[model samples]
Target: MLAVLQVILLVLDIVWWLVIVSAILSWLFAFNVVNARNPVVDSIGNFLYRATEPLYRPIRRVLPDLGGIDLSPLVVLLLIFFIQQVIVLYLIPAVYRAGV
Candidate 1:
């Protein structure tokens, strides 16, 4: 059961990385660095925005706008990655248990 939990945590970490990549790509498309005209880019960007927006929305409200810039995405990324690190720490217990 401990080993199974470790595997689940690892998968969660992977999913967080996927979210980060999607957020970055979405920003790139929005800024026109990537061709937003492409159908695939459009779909991916919209979907990413939808996925990540809920986290950003509340953060955006409390935080002051930095001259129209939104730092909520950065905040979301940091929080998600930090939680992933905590999840990885659970594996040490699983390893110790396996030794016995």
Candidate 2:
């Protein structure tokens, strides 16, 4: 059970990084800093979009348009952080107590 919790924590950490990278890549694409015409760049962008878009779609619907700015990523990051904290501070301790 502890091992399973650890695996979940690790996966959450990895996804946190993915969110950051995806946001940066989106910004670069938006600002024309990266050329999406290149196959490599396009592929990476598509991958990030596919990974993140589903999560963002619901948040986007809830949030009113801010003229082109997107806040879903920030909201998602906050949610991920909150979940991580809950698992670390509450769930893991509960599991440890249960084992004893």
**What TM-score would each prediction reach against the true structure?**
0.65, 0.94
Regions of candidate 1 where Cα sits further than 4 Å from its true position: 1-4, 7-11, 90-100
Clashing pairs in 1: none
The per-model lDDT (C-alpha) reads 0.74, 0.92
Best by TM-score: 2
Task: Report the poorest 10 consecutive residues by lDDT, candidate 2.
Answer: 11-20
| Model 2 agreement with the true structure over 1-100: per-residue lDDT tens digits | 9898899989888888888999999999889999999999999989988988988999999999999888999999999899899999999999999993
What are the RMSDs of all candidates, in order? 3.3, 1.1
Residue 48's lDDT in candidate 2:
89
